[model samples]
Target: MRWGVLGASAAISRRVMPAIAAGGPTTLAAVAGRPQSAARTTEVAAAYGARAHHDYGALLADPAIEAVYIALPNSEHVGWTLRALDAGKHVLVEKPMALSEADAVRVQEAADAARRTVMEAFMYRFHPQQRRAADLLASGEIGDLRVVRASFAFLMGAAPGDIRLAPGLGGGATWDVGCYAVDAAMLHFGRAPRAVRAVLSRRPGADVDTSGTVLLDFGEGRSAVLDHSMDYGPRSWMELQGTHGSITIRNAWAGADEDGTLTVLGYAGTREESVPAADHYRLQVLALTDAARAGTPAPIPLSDSLRTVRVLEAVFASAADDGAAVPVAEEGTG
Candidate 1:
């Protein structure tokens, strides 16, 4: 499979693009963006020896591009993902996949009808440390699943007119960073929470949340807590606690080094440990390629992402009601 990038988003140009360049099954083919930004896109693509286009549609229309990565702002996710899928291109879109559940459903429906793969790019899930964390839980390192606490946050800093603070760009800690925390909790628990509640701090007159706390109740049996912030300081931390032992993942969001020598706080000892894979993004690309080639569902199903949206929506709703707990969707999320 040959992959094309929809825009020269920093994440792609830096972390994600380098991993794809590290040589998995597929090759980077081309990158595209608005003409005003294509110069930078072209520069990055040239560094990788790939073609560059000024028009995004033209890039998608290119017959050689089998798969494409959509790294646009959060608000543009649904439209571009659907467009790419409709153009007969498989997609790896940045999370959260859409601004609303309806948009996510539309994107997934388009993919289903086209028999194309559309994966939400929660790249952290592809890391071997995450799998290792899961393994630790399964191996009874943590006696019985009790509580999972994860946080992914950092100060976006004061960038005047930045999209992160603008409501129209789908900017906010909730969609920007909170989604990762939610994704981590859901993935660790391996199911939607039984109930969710949130507390959000909003900038005056801004329609977006800057920082928030999400409390997820798995059931009478388990619970997960996640916190996200766009202001404060730099931090990426996670811990899983149970009856026996616990697991700690420092720098969980950004991923570890190639050998997966991430600082793991566990029974193995609190030191850097080597995981199987080298690069998280490469693993994600490889998974996407295999899923697209096999005509099967993504490793993380689209419905799972939709369910997350429902959870976020419920969080906001609950917050609106002064943090009253709200149940996750019971059924019908196609």
Candidate 2:
């Protein structure tokens, strides 16, 4: 598969682009960046041996590019994804596919209309450790799952112009890091939440949240507790507690050369397993490329993206209401 990148962001230059070059049966054909960053874009493209286009449309128009990785900011995800689909190119967009459920549905409709594959770039989902954990849950090694606790946080420097702290750019602790916890919970429970209640903390004069805690009720005594922050010490992990035992995953989201661990405790005994280090980004690229070639559904379908966004919407609403519980709207409805 031949690929084009829509931005010259750090993630693109340092991770996905390199993954494309080394990932199986894929080529880094082109890259596009804003006109103001033409030099940086050219430098990035040259490093990867790909053509550079200052305008995103020019890269999309390239006949040799079969798919595109949209690394633009959260606000630009939906628009660029729709444009890429319209250009007859498959899309693998960054996480939080949309800031809202409506935009996610729009992207889904456009992808279906274009008969193109579209996937959210939740690279961690492609990691082998995730699969192992899922298998353990499926095998009933942890009886019936009753609760999930997940958190992802890191300190953000007091930079005045960081995009993650900009409201207009869809920046917030929940949107930036909380989505991973929400996604992990949903992945384990295999269903969307029924309701959500959240509380957020914002620094003085800041319009966006710097930290938040959310409770998702999945009904029937099943639930997830999630918390995220941009002003906390680094921590990332998820634990699933069940009737019989529990499973804890350390560093749940593995990056390049980062190995994770899974510990399962039950009536039988406590066992710890080491997950081999792997580049999930490379795995993600290969998976999407293979799916595109086979003309099959995306590895991470748009519907899943919609559910995640719906839950996020409920979280934000609840926070705005002073932590009052908010019901998550059903799919295809308001």
Candidate 3:
């Protein structure tokens, strides 16, 4: 698959681009950024042996590019995804595919019309550690899954006017990091939450949330708690508790840096299993390319993206309503 990039975000220049260069069945054909950042975009593109465009449309217009990876701001995801599909290109959009369930549905509709692959880029899901964890839970190693607790937090130390601090850009701890926690819970449980409640800590002069905790009620005596913060020091982990045992993952989100371990504490005895360090970003690109070439279903389907945003919508609504419980909107619900 020949790929083009739609932005010069940190995730793209620092991670995705490198991954695309190192892994294949895919190639970085071209890249584009905001017109004002043409120089930086050119530098990045040149580093990966790709052509650079002054604007996103030009990259999409490149007939050689069969797919586009969008690392644009969260608020821009749906719009760009629609455009990419309309351009006859498959898309691997950055996570939180849309800010609302309604918009996610819109993206799904566009993709259906285009008959193109549109997947949310949740690279962590492709990690060996994540796959191994899912296997263990499915094999009843952890027994009946009961609860999930996950946290992803880090100090921003961002300069003034960083896009992450901009409300109009969909900047917030939830949209940025909390999405990973929520995703982990859903991945383990294999379903969406029935209801959600949250308490958010807002930035003093910004409209975006800086920190928050969200609770997902899955019923059947199952639930999940997710925590995220942009102002806190780095701390990330996930724990799944069940009837007969529990599974714990440290450094759950980015297992790319080093070998990751999953600890199982069950009825018989405690054991720790190791998964070798691997570039999940590279693995994700490979998956996308393979699916696209084979005309197979996307690894991260639109339905899953819509489900996650529905839960997120409920989380934000509950937080805005002073921590009142909010029912996750069913399809077509207002």
Candidate 4:
């Protein structure tokens, strides 16, 4: 898969671009950045032997590029994805594919019409530990799954200019980090929650949330508790509790090499499962490329992306209403 990157963002430089450079069925063909960042973009592209474009449209116009990796800001995800699809290119877009379920639906419709593959870039899902954890839950190693608790928090510098602190750019701790926790819960439960409630904390004079705690009701006495923050010290972990036992994963989101662990505590005794070090970003790239070549649905389908946005919308609504319980919108509903 010949790939073009839509931005010269830190994520692109630090993770995805390196993954693309790593030997696989994928290659870095080009990179595009705004005029102000042209030099940096050129440097990044040259590091991997790919072309660089000052304009996103120019990169899209490059016929040699078969796919696009959108590492743009959260607010730009939907528009670029739609544009990439119209350009006859498959897209692997950064998470929070759309701020709303409605926008996600539009991207889904566009991708289907274009007959191109589109995937939300949730790299952690491709990690072996995530799959192993899921398998353990499915094999009844954790008995009947009852509850999920996830937390992803990290302190951000008090830089007022950071994109993460800008409301108009879809900036917020919830959108940036809480989405991971929500996705983890949904992945394990395999269904959308019926309702959600959340309490948010915001810095004075800032419109975006700095921290939040959300509750997802999955019915049948099952639920998920999620918390995220940009004001707290670094913490990332998820725990799944069941009738008989529980599974805990450390470094659930940041899958650095050999830095993750999955511990299972069941009826028999406590045991730690060894999850080998692996580059999930490269795994994601390979998976999407293979699926695109085979004309199969993306590994992270648009429907799943839509469901996650729906849940996020509900979370925001509940937070705005002072933590009132907000019901998640069903598919095809406004």
RMSD of 3: 1.4
* Number of clashing pairs per prediction, in order: 0, 0, 0, 0
Q: Write the per-residue lDDT of candidate 2 for residues 40-134, one digit (tens) a residue.
A: 99999999899999999999999899999999889999999998998999999988799988899899899899989999999989888898999
Candidate 3 overall lDDT versus native: 0.87
What TM-score does model 2 achieve against the real structure? 0.98
Candidate 4 lDDT over 203-287, as tens digits, reads: 7777799999999999999999999999996989999999999999977886647556889998799988878888899999988
lDDT of 1 at 137: 77
Candidate 3 local lDDT, residue 62: 88
lDDT of 4 at 295: 99
TM values, all candidates: 0.92, 0.98, 0.96, 0.98
- Tens digit of per-residue lDDT, candidate 3, span 140-257: 9778999999999999865688878888999899999999998889878888888899999976676689999999999899999889999895878888998999989877886567
By lDDT, rank the candidates, best first: 2, 4, 3, 1
Error of 1 at 1 (Å): 1.1
Score each candidate by Cα lDDT.
0.82, 0.91, 0.87, 0.90
Question: What is the per-residue lDDT of model 1 for residues 201-282, given as tens digits with 9 covering 90 to 100?
Answer: 8755556788899899999778888888887658788888877667777667655353443454546556555565557778
* Residue-level lDDT for 254 in candidate 3: 67
Candidate 1 TM-score over all chains jointly: 0.92
Provide the clash count, candidate 2.
0
